[model samples]
Target: MVNITKDTEKEELIAQFWPQISRAAAGYENRPALSDELAQEMALSVWRSLEGFNDQCSLSTYIYRVIHNTAIDHIRRHSKISEDELDEAMLCESPTPEKNTLQAQRQKQLIVAVNQLPLSLRQVMLLKLEDLNNIEMSEVLGISEANVGVRLHRAKEQLSKLLAGMN
Candidate 1:
């Protein structure tokens, strides 16, 4: 809720973008404590970077770029992600507890596999999970749309292999 500028407040930005920030952070670090710490760091980075934001890209795009950069910095500092399950509440509610349990297991497995990807492919997959179009991902990652497409394709292939080996 700290004031960033007369026009916009940090709290307002956090409220609007916290989900994306959290998801991006979790993509980098799975352990709950570390992921939460990364999310806070990303929010602070976004708050600090807000003043520099121009209309060159959408606010979502700007927010994503800041968070991803924060995540990369976090990875460099921390150097590893310990295995952990995602919060169950983050998963869809199934008709039964058994189905929900199974779904959660699969999701956890998928996340673990994703965490094993090379950084370049991991970045694209995480952005893709956030539903970014290739163009948006390109702008956020400062790569070409074609590169995004290639990475996404490779990520999907690799994830399939990783998940298969998990079973």
Candidate 2:
């Protein structure tokens, strides 16, 4: 556990990393607003775990991994989806918007489809969308750069299929 003694260095570290933590958390916005609460919890966990960090990865990468694991943990804890709930959720269709709506329905559908991707693929895609190169994504995801490329390819394929099916 990281001892947060009343030290300026510890305070500075926390301040520097908070935005990365929040950006990592933003990946979960498609889930319930509970994700924000979970993000806060994860940030606290990262702070507590900081002393043990050995600088194996960049600070940003480490924080992102922490946030990702925290979100997965939260989902596991709260996701008690029964068969009926799954069926109902699967049956729920995107709502049609009027012609004058600010955003196109297709765009909304695409967003929903992206949100439905499995966590690993979704995380990769989100990081890619944020313009991180494969090396950076590899660090953030604790995978090889080649694996990052493969996953991004598969994620794009899956998203394409999902969007096609939505139409």
Candidate 3:
């Protein structure tokens, strides 16, 4: 296994995990512009926190914690401003010509549904999407493994209801 060293470039590390960072940010902020900004903030935060990464857990777990923490910060910073409610009609009935594929449309709908979930559930769902197991999620979230399982179960149930409503 290649070990991370001080000489490892931040650009390389960020590039490797950009997809995860972006996805986590998008889960927190439905607005693409704000999500992009959050992802950038996460990348910078990861670089700054790299020195503190003692290998107590997997590197991916550490990165997720950083990204999620940054997302929480973003939410707190913008808490005073009310976000526009997502229209249920817009979630499913958007017949935009550009997005022609059925799968793409469904994916977009799922993302919208996920974004509508409460923050606690949303965090678990997003990390679950990243393929993190309960233990890993608990470590990153600072919650118990049992709590992770409960949250994941709740997230799935809510997502199902949300998606069902869309159909």
Candidate 4:
């Protein structure tokens, strides 16, 4: 009975947050294989961290914090994910026996452009994409709401320039 209760709690935890965690990892790494690895790592971390979770923040915000921190750690260990690498990642996903869909191509371009951004800008964009409000993003990134707004604005400008150049 004790084991069953613990297992059910862990399952609930994983089910509740896995999509957000996976999406964040995908945006952060921009590489399917790496993102998959990161998502698994994040899930494990969440399971471990749940043992001592406090109610200081909403669970969603806390999960975002963990995902963001994991992303930073991944970036530190393997700094500078390059444009060529992004291109290669895209190429690897190209359709076989069928032409590439326009939507897929645009998504690939957007991902590449995003990956080219500086860390601050990238972090802002990623959090914003996840539909997090500025306040929640501030909590995740440990910055002021004003600063998040500034970074997000700058990141949008840079992304426009990058996409324009790419196209």
TM-scores of the models, in the order given: 0.85, 0.67, 0.86, 0.87
Tens digit of lDDT per residue, candidate 1, span 25-115? 8788877778999999999999888878777888889889999999999999986643334444334334567655878779778777888
In model 1, which residue pairs have backbone atoms overlapping below 3 Å? none
lDDT of 4 by residue, 1-167 (tens): 12222767877978888888887787778778888998888888777766555777777787788878888888888756676887787778748533366776677677778878898999999888889999999998999999999999999999999999988
Query: Which 10 consecutive residues of model 4 have the lowest summed lDDT?
Result: 1-10
Better of 2 and 4 by lDDT: 4
Q: State model 2's lDDT.
A: 0.70
Scored by TM-score, the top model is 4
The clash tally of candidate 2 reads: 0
Per-residue accuracy of model 3 over 1-167 as CA lDDT, tens digit each:
33455646666888999999988887788665677898899999998887778888888888899999999999988752233444533444547675788887888888888888888999999999999999999999999999999999999999999999989
Deviation in angstroms for 17 in model 1? 0.8
Q: Listing every candidate in turn, what is its Cα RMSD in Å to the true structure after a full C-alpha superposition?
A: 5.0, 5.3, 3.4, 3.5
After aligning candidate 4 to the native by TM-score, how far in Å is the CA of 163 from where it should be? 1.1
Two-way TM-score contest, 2 vs 4, winner = 4
Candidate 3 stretches greater than 4 Å from native: 1-8, 80-98
Clashing pairs in model 4, backbone N/Cα/C closer than 3 A: none
Better of 1 and 3 by TM-score: 3
Model 2 spans > 4 angstroms off: 1-20, 80-110, 164-167
